[model samples]
Target: MATPVLSAERLAASYTYHAYRQLIDDLQAEGKTTGPQQSELLTNYTRLNVQRMHRLDKTVQLLPELREALAALRKPYVWLIITEGWCGDAAQIVPVLEAVAQASAGNITTHFLLRDDNLDLMDQYLTAGGRSIPKLVVLDAATLTEVANWGPRPATAQQMFLDLKSQDLPFEEFSTQLHGWYAKDKTQSTQRELLALLKSL
Candidate 1:
């Protein structure tokens, strides 16, 4: 049998974007990261992600068209985002998503769930069979059923990742290049893609 769809109760239990940020902050205070695996490396990534999120939250600007679209949305939707604190892409992407939701004039709400904590859901939305995170499942607020989804990374960034993976570079070098891409792109790709998604809905 197929797995059951996500439920309203699960969304209720999930963290709001604000609470999720605070959870990461609290974990940082304890020298920890989200997920079952704990390590110095993962903790270090979480530290770096905190800086990334802080910067993005302050700097990401939505396009006027995207903002207009969000403001015009009439139906209520929930953006259920699956991510982890140590996820670099999530750090880069989640803030932009929050910005979009904030622009939606109460039409869009966002909830965050840790990928490891929601493996069943994560499995259903895997990127190439891997549980790549920052997976966004857009649900109809009234029915709690999926309407659309996007994530792991923007299309351009995902391609960059595939290329880097093929090259088999060290994690540090690989990460630096990937994040450099996000830094240069400045959330434009993310917003544009979501704008397209919104138009289709």
Candidate 2:
């Protein structure tokens, strides 16, 4: 089956990094924020992750290798992210991605589409048969062809989740351990995996 072409104009109309930050702020101000599959606890966690990512956006410095890789890109591409305001993983990963796009020196443009509102696009990039949030889909701007994709979480974190799943732990315990892993990671695994994806492309 052929990969579906995502609408660039739609993506352009979607949130920019700054706009996404603003949306998160607005949602928090409303005293409520919830996605399709999120519970109250997850919603609260997502808010916290958004705040953490905002801080990271200000302080995240690219390593030398990543800098060189981003700097070397000559072809134009779109780093299209599918996410929602109440997705904790998206909050953690999106800002790091935004920082990378900024360092690309205009070779790449990053945009975000809310997954709930874009089911067609979301279905094209499902993770493990599930609609995982914070999916990063790289598209060639000129042709709108999807070149690569990465998402949900880094391999290390995903493995941790699978291990936790095998134990059939309670949702509260599972989420606490999962997010604690993300807290300690500091986006290193995310950056490393994305850098690898960029190199392959």
Candidate 3:
């Protein structure tokens, strides 16, 4: 058979909705007020780093292999993203998951769970078992059983992209770093390594 053409994802359109803009505003508020010079540094960081998650084409270019890794998965994956609106990680990964959802007949469902509003839900993840904000709970939607997870820090791919972009490394190198982190077995080590590795991406 001929290679299949990828169709456009509708939810993907709504995925980046006003929610992301609100995140940008929140992110600004969360930052400590700095002198004009120091503020300029962060401005550059965000300007250089503000990840517009809605643009599918640009995101893929930022990390082609990572996108493929997500594309390879079969979904119906319930992605409960426990996050604060101000978090940079949420800004990055939510869009990637949205794109993945767009690709696979909506196999992925991206739910943004605000940390302050959903204490019970978050406490479950933030506990020893629970983890932190931007924790991606990838589960079997039907059974409500978890399958796999990635996040809190490396939770959002846009953050990773910014890290990679800052280093000015090519996409292949970024993919190499990410997969290496995923390959680790211990949870604590896995989380730490992934965060460190993404920072290097």
Prediction RMSDs, each to the true structure:
1.8, 2.1, 12.9
How many backbone clashes does every candidate have? Answer: 0, 0, 7
- Candidate 1, 1-201: lDDT as tens digits: 333258778889999999999999999899999999999999999999999999998998889999878877889999999999999999999999999999898999999999999898899898898999899998888888788899989999999999999999999999999999998998999999999999988
Best by lDDT: 1
Off by over 4 Å in 2: 1-4, 34-39
Structural RMSD, model 2:
2.1
Using TM-score as the measure, the top candidate is 1
How high is the CA lDDT of each candidate model?
A: 0.92, 0.82, 0.48
111-130 in candidate 3: lDDT tens per residue? 65556655655666653464
Of 1 and 2, the candidate ranking higher by lDDT:
1
Cα error, residue 35 of model 2, in Å, equals 3.9
The candidates, ranked best first by lDDT, are 1, 2, 3
Worst 10 residues of 1 by lDDT: 1-10
Q: Candidate 3: lDDT of 54? A: 38
Model 1 regions more than 4 Å off: 1-4
